[model samples]
Target: MSRDQLVTLAQALRELGGAVPEPVPSGAREDSSFSGGRARKISVSMPEDLSAAVQQRVGRGEFSKYVTEAVAQRLESDLLAELVGLLDEEHGEVPEDLVAEAEGAWPDVE
Candidate 1:
């Protein structure tokens, strides 16, 4: 992917509350987060155009990796949303001023 595409992807992931991947801490395996299970094959249905688009972006050898990463991203995003919803339910609505302040502090973020 182009640098701009990568940046856009990262931004979208962040907006969905995906945690950015960081270096493994000392004594931890680099793939510890994803290494437990044997790889499995699965089939999915998608629009013809969407499937074509994915294929264009990824080579045949990398298609599985691309799909795996996409699925992981969505799962993390859903988990983050769920946690935020739980927090909101417990704490009630956040104050407008605090929201505004947060936006102001990170003006570049959408």
Candidate 2:
């Protein structure tokens, strides 16, 4: 991604109160051979209240795993949103009936 895209993504993550990871250096290979189950240690900052709430739910020992899962989900959501935007640009907006049919097929959970 371009530096501008990286900056935009970092800003979006910060807006969501997520710990934005360090950006990859320019010209670096974007993909790594690291396995999904492998872990890397990195420091991150978050609000005290949010930290406390997460700790209260998952306890300190499981904090890293919890954060990892949350970040992964957020990235997936962002990618899906981007794909939708691309589709909209190419094909115009989705029809309301089609959207309603999709909603009926996969209704939102409480």
Best by lDDT: 2
Off by over 4 Å in 1: 1-37
Off by over 4 Å in 2: 1-35, 107-110
- Write candidate 2's Cα lDDT for 1-110 as tens digits: 34446556666655555565554334222232212233556899999999999999997687876776676456556644665565576679999999888889887743
Error of 1 at 66 (Å): 1.2
For model 1 the local lDDT of residue 80 reads 52
Residue 93 CA displacement from its true place in model 1, Å:
1.7
Worst 10 residues of 1 by lDDT: 23-32
TM-scores, all candidates, are 0.64, 0.61
The TM-score measured for candidate 2 stands at: 0.61
**How much lDDT does each candidate structure score?**
0.59, 0.61
Best candidate (score: TM-score): 1
Question: Which residue pairs of candidate 1 clash?
Answer: none
